[model samples]
Every structure is written in structure tokens, then in C-alpha cells.
Target: MSTAVATATPTARPTSRRRRRIGSTEIVYLALVGILVVAGVLVAMGGGNLFSTANTAYMLTQTSLLGFVAIGQTFVILCRSLDLSVGYVVALCSIVGATTMAGDPSRVWLGVVAALAAAAGIGLVNGLVVTKLRVNAFIATLGVGLIVKGYLDTQFKGPAGDVPSSFQMFGYTRVGPVPISTIVMLVVAAVGIVLLTRTRQGYHMFAVGGNVDVARLSGIRADRTVIIAHVLCSTCAGIAGLLIAARFGTGNALVYSYGLDLDSIAAVVLGGTLLLGGRGSVAGTVGGVLILAVLDTVFNVLDVDPFFKDVLRGVVIIAAVALYARRQIDPASSRARFRSNRRRDPVRSGARPDPTTTDGGASA
Candidate 1:
């Protein structure tokens, strides 16, 4: 018998390149930041006084309030759900805070606490309806918003009067030349980022949004994750309402009459989170808010009519979504090319087939 030994096959080096050429999140962030910078430059060139301290402060303050709402919207959107009740929640909380505090500086803290509690309660109810009752998030939140709006209207019977002086400080006060509202917004964004990136709960949220059935089978409590997301979102909205009321020194019950949901959704989408869910970042959200604020300020400085602003916003949002969609599709082609290359590699021949491996061969 001739002793024949099979020649040892050299193992192919695993490609160090990441499977994903460009992460959607990274691309979205870069694109948003680029847009913001360009818009800022255009506004400056258009005599918008982009470098003025007052103008910068104004932009920060304006973005701060909307930013808070967008942050809340981020959570809901991440969970693959919608929260239509944010505007109503803001209106209700603002009314409650204004009427109860009503120029009583000392009672500002009480009003703040009450508003937050009310907001959280509303969020809990929304979560219960969606998770327990199996109601769709859109319809359920819409109905809840209407009910809250009606309830607030009944209580106010009209627009709210002046807010407390202490409460006003939240929106108007500054720290080392920075608006308090802006600081608060930054803090909220920071907290949200930490929660989503560092916690196990955050992983569960992604899993839940990515695939509810698979997450459930994998021992994650999808329902709880969604419910938590809703609660957190509403709480953020409530804080935003307080800030808005403080800024104007009054709560008109119609403060949220413009339907903030649409703007919030637009900001979230612009930030790179898919409407279908499971992917995004708080940093991207901040960029999106800045972009919107810049655009709004530019339009105002240009003396564009408010109605025209809506048209502009619609166009920008559509464009952003289209770009994002294109980016999402780009990866598929790269993946296919990678698969083809692997299939043509001779090293794969005569190996025990392993479908789970990217190269379709057993690991050496």
C-alpha cells in the first residue's frame, strides 16, 4: 500500500473589510451635517446674520424646543411605531402648567412636576393600548391625542394666560451665554444616546423593532421594550411643552395647533432612522434638528411666507428620504458581488459546505 498524504491546504485569509461598505447611520449623519453646513453658509451669504450672537442664540432656543420633541419622536420611530399624541400632550401639559402656575413663581416646581407626571401617565396609557389591547400605534395615539385635546379645551375654555416667572426662566435663562433651553435639550439628547448605546434595554429595543417575533423567541420582551419607548417619548414631549410654555410666558391651548407630529417625523426621518424602524442614532437626530432650524431661520430672513416654508420643507424631506432609500439599496449590490467572488474562489472547492459561513466553506 502506498502511503499517500493529502497536501495541507493553505487557509484563505479572512477579508478584514467589514461586510458593510458604508453604514447607513454614518452616511446619514455625514449627509445631514453637510446639509446643515451648506445651509448655514447660504444663510450667512443671504444677509441672515448667521454670525451674530443674538441670531445664534435665537437659533439655539428655537431648535431646543423642537429638538426635544424630535428626541421623543426618535424613540417612537426607533420602535417602528408612531406617536401622534405628542402635540396634544404638549398642549395639555402646557395648559396645565400655565393655569396652575399662573404667575406664581413659587409654584413653578409643582407645575413642572405635575406636567411631567401627566405626560408619563398619558404615555403609559398609549403603551397599554398598543401593547395590551393590540391597537395600532397610529390610530391609538391619534385617538388619545384627540381625547387629550378635547379635555384640555374643556378645562381651559380658551387660550392660557401668562406663565410663572420662575417657569419662564427655563426658556429664557442662560448659562455662560448659552440658553437654558438649549442646555436642557443637549442634556436630554446625551441621556438618550447613553441609554440607547450602553444598556441591554437598548439592545432589546433594536431586536424588538428589527423583528418582533424573532426577538420574542430569543427571550426578549418586545412588548415591554415598546411600552418603555412610548413612555420615554411622551415624557420628553412633556418636557418640550414646558419649555415652549416658558418661552412664550403663556400656554395658548393652541400652542401645538400646528401639528408637531409631522415636523417631528420629518426630523427623525432626516436623521436617518427608517420609518420601518430598528436603526438610528441620537446624534443624527441632533443634526436633523439643526438642519431644520437652519432652514427655518434662512426662510424667515429671506421673508418667505409661512405657507411657502411648508412647501420647502416638504421638498427637503422628500429629497432626504429619497437619498436615504438609495443608500439603503446600495448595499445589496455590494453583498451580491461579495457572494459571487466567494463562489468563484477555488479554495471553496472540495470543502464541507457550510451555508452559515459567508464564504460557503468550513472555517480552517
Candidate 2:
């Protein structure tokens, strides 16, 4: 009889993993900080202060309205759908909310409920058109917007209805430089962050956005997710409508002319959410909103021409999208990350090598 033993070569552990480069979100904030610094210097050069009380207030006030809509835009974009009707939704809801309130404090709640209900209903229609009717999201939303606009154009000649002083507090009240509207917008953003990270619907949004076919294969109801996303998006637009009513004391039929539909989409894209969908964060969107706010402030302070403001904004948006396109997550990095995780979670992966295991046998 002879004994035979085999010694397996020990699997060497990776000594180090490549550090993750800064993510698109982190880079966005860094760019924002850079812009603030540069803008501050420019303003100071002109014998003006960028952080003046009035300037801060104005920047934040603008940010609040855009933030609300952008956050909602984030939801639908994450589900791979776009809502071109948000500007119109804001217009409609402002009219609905303000008209229902009719300058009566007691009717504020009723107005809010009515406005939100209307926005949600429109969202349902938009979703149905896309899902049930098999229409493209862009065309479906645009068509819905046109329908809403036609009604607005025919029925109202100018601003109508008014918000009472009590409701106006939502737009005017502030904690120091921060308006209550901005604070509420931040709260909404917090809620959005939680939804994306800790809820089933949030996960479904990602799954559906990643690939509708794959999502269905995995038992996710993609259409339902999109509808929910649009509803949430429209509800956010409704909240924005309330802000408009609060600030202006009435519903302005021309509010959509501010070009918010494109602005909100730009902010979403600026936040690093893929235009095609499936990847982004509310925090990032907030940062993007702030960036735009800063630019608006800077332009006002520098006395840049209104036409030039649009051009500059266009440049920034294009540059940002192009810059971040190179930084998207790649398969090589993903595999490396998996290996790194497996190494740290030895028991879970069971792939970690153990040098101590050996084989010994005796054969006759």
C-alpha cells in the first residue's frame, strides 16, 4: 500500500482593490462649489457681494419652485419615462388650487386636495396613453400638454384666482434666508431619497428603468411602475403650482412660458440621472438645482443679457452632460467591485481561498 498526498496551490488574495473614483454625484457638488467660488470672485470684482441677503433670498426662492418639479422629474426619469407636461401641470394645478381657495383661508386644504387630485388624474392619463395605448412617452406627454394648453388658452385670458395671506405664507415665510417653500422642497427631496433607497416601488423603478423586458421577466410590473412614477411626478408639479400661487397671489396662465419643462429636465440630467433613466439620486438633483440657481444669481449680478443667459445655460448643460458621460459605471469596475465585496464577505461568497485545506489518502 502506498500513501498519496496532494498539496493544492494556495490562491493568493488580491492585496488591494482599485479605489472608486469620484462618482458623478460627488463631482456635481464639486463643480457647484467651484462655480460658487468663481462667481463670488466675479461679483466681488464688480464691487458687489454674492452672499448679500437679498441675493441669497432671490436665489433660494427661484430654487424652491424648480426643485419641486425637478425632484418629481427624477422619479419618472428613473422609471425611463419623461413628462413634458409638467409646466402645463403646474399651470393647471395653480389655477385649480387658487380658484378653489378663492382667497379664502378656510378653503386652502380643499384647494390643495383638488389641485393634487387633478394633477394625479392627468398623470394617470399620461401613463395610460404610454402603457395601454402604446404611445411614445414624449409624444403622449406633449400631446397631453397641448390639450391642456388649448383649454387654458380658450378658457382664461390672464391670471385668475388668488391665494389668501395664510396660504401665501408657504411661499414667503422663511427661517433666516431659507424660505419655507425651499424647506418643504427639501423635505420632499428627503422623502424621495427614502423612496428610492428603502422602498419596493423605488427598487421597481430602478428595475424597470434598467430594462423593461428584463423587469417583466423578473416579475416586476413595468407599466404600473411607470404610472406610479408619473403620478408622483405630477403631484410634485402640483406642489409647484401651489408655490406659484402662493408667490404671485394668483394663478398665472403664462407660468409655463418660464420654460420649466426643459429646465427641470436639464436639472435632472445635470444631477447625473441618465437621460435614458435607471440611475440617479434626489440629493444629486438638489445639488443640480442649486447650481442653476447660482448661475441665475450670477447672471443677474453680472447684468448679463437675458439672451446671453440662455446661451450660457445651454453651454453649461451640454458641457456637463458630455463631461459625465465618460464616468459612467463600467463592467470591468463592477466585476472588480464584486471581487472586492466577495473578499470581504468570505462566508457569504465561499470563494475565498483557504490555504490550510489538504488531501491525504492511502491506497492498497
Candidate 3:
């Protein structure tokens, strides 16, 4: 009887898997590629040679410094923090590195070490100020940046000592048609990718940024994660500073002090890394960097006014952010939420449901 009953039972149906959705990061990357195509068209329209080897190399080389800084900024933002002091950190490190080099090739390593140490120290202080003192990251980092910039201004009026030959070589040397600095930027991005996607530390970082209270409940050290992120961000800025000094073969107190911090933030945020933290990817940030570089190149080729370019960029950023925000909602869930709200409404309880009613009970 048991065997007969088992045979008579109907077979269970297999559950269908939902198709995976394209995330904001991938969408942003696609948009970046589209922008590049548009930029190429603009260059052609402007009678500029966009496909020339010279232009390609120039774009890559120019992007390397900003790319490195943006990668670091991505890390910090992923941890739900901001590091406004990176611009000043870059300035201070470049000046210190060049001064230590003193036109002496043999001292290049020493200068590099000194610069990195200084950056790390500044990062540590920023971390402590945020994590220990409970200061808002924006205010803390900005204050620290002001202090660093003030000291830098007091120490040097203009460009300081010359960079060493060895240091300069790193920026100039190329593999075939590519600059070594570009290669370095690519490697840094790769490392960032691996760190965020494959490592335990990376998991903890996302957890912390996603929700600090939940992360702490889960035994993650949110404070330590933030401190580490700041240190890494500062280190990245220091590396960018070294590259900047190498490319210029000199360092100045104020040459690179402007716009770098803002650029990093813009690129990272545009890459679709959540400004609030938790979700992000290094690859998306790379696309973001490229988008910025392409836009700058196109604008220069077209001879657009610098002020107008800035305004255009601001508009683009706002548009990209708004598009991403709209994508965050699921139509199905939104409808379900509306239905749930209607069911709980006292007026709705006595009346028939109105499909056209909006959230505030107004007719759509």
C-alpha cells in the first residue's frame, strides 16, 4: 500500500530562477562607453584628431594620476567615509619628496619613503579624528586639509626642488606605446578589484559601510575598517603625488592643490559607487576616470571655454546621479508597497480601492 501511494504522488515542479538584473555599476560603465563614443564624434566635428596615437597616449598618461586618487577615494567611500585631505596630502608629499631628492638621483628612494611616511601619518591622524573623536568626516578632513595647506604655503612660495632623474623615469618610461604610469594605474585598479571582491577584509569593509550597527552586531570592527580605509586612501594619494612630481620633475606648494579632491569624489560617485557606502566596484571607478579624461580631452579639442566646461560637467554629474537614483526602485515592489499602504488606510478600509490613487491618497 505504501509503494502504491508513493507511485501515485505527483512530481514536484522545479522552481524557475529569476533573471539577474544589471546593476547600477554595470549601467554606469555602459554609459561611460557611450560618452566616449560621443566624445570621439565631438573631436571629429571639432577637426581634432581623436584617433591619433599622440592623443591616445596623452589621455592615458593624464588619467593615471587622477585614476589612482579616485581608486583610493572609492575605498574610503565604500567604507562610508570621506577623505577631503587627499589633495593637500598629495601636495605635501610631492614637495617633501622633491626637496629630499634635491636633484640627487641617489636619494630618490629616500624621498619616496619620506613622502609615503608623511602621507601615512596624515592618514592615521585623519582616521583617529573621525573614528575616535566622533567628528563628521567632511569637517574633520577639511580642517586637516586646511592645516596641511597652510603649512605647505608657509614653507614654499612656488615650485620647490627638482625631482631626481630616477624618479622622473617612472613617469616617462613606456611599454611600447603605453606609459608606465598608466600601467601602474591599471595594476592598482586590479589590486583594488581583488581586495574588494576576493578578500575577507573587503567583505568586512562592505559590511561596515552597509550598516555599522549591523556590522558591529556581526562582530566586525567598523572603526578599524574605517581607519584602514583612510590609511590606504592617503597612501594612494602619496603614490599619485610621487607620479606627479616625476612627470613634472619638480614640486610646487600649490600647483596640484586645486580640484583633485573634488575630482576624486566626482569620479567615484559617478562610477555608481553608492555615496552612502556599502556597494561599489573598482572597475566602475576605472570607467568613471576614463569618462572624465575623455570629456576633458574632447572639451580641449573643441576649445570650449573652461568656465562653460565646468558648468557642463556639473550638469552631467547631476543627471547621472538622478538616473541612478531612479533605477534603485523596483516597479513590482513599488506597486506592492502602494497596495499595502492602501490596505492599512482608514479611508480605504471603508471605500473601494482606487487604482489611480497616489501615495498621499490623491488621484494620479
Best by lDDT: 2
For residues 1-364, what per-residue lDDT tens digits would candidate 2 score against the true structure?
Answer: 6655556666687576567788878989999999999999999999999999899999999899999999999998998899999999999999999999999999999999999999999999999998999999999999999999999889879988989999999989989998999999999999999999999999999999989999999999999999999999999999999999998899987787888899999999998999888889899999999999999999999999999999999999999998887667466868977987887787889775454454453334
Clash list (residue pairs), candidate 3: none
Q: For residues 166-242, could you state the per-residue lDDT of candidate 1 as single tens digits?
A: 67889889875579899989999999999889999888877887888999999998889989999998999899888
Query: Which run of 10 residues does model 3 get worst, by summed lDDT?
Result: 1-10
lDDT of 3 by residue, 217-296 (tens): 99998999999899889999999988878988888678554689999999998888888999888898888888888788
Q: Name model 3 segments beyond 4 Å from true.
A: 1-17, 336-364
Clash counts per candidate, in order, are 0, 0, 0
TM-scores, in order shown? Answer: 0.85, 0.88, 0.86
In candidate 2, how many Å is residue 231 off? 0.4
Give the TM-score comparing model 1 with the true structure, all chains together: 0.85
CA-lDDT, candidates in order: 0.82, 0.91, 0.86
TM-score of 3: 0.86
Candidate 1 weakest lDDT stretch, 10 residues: 354-363
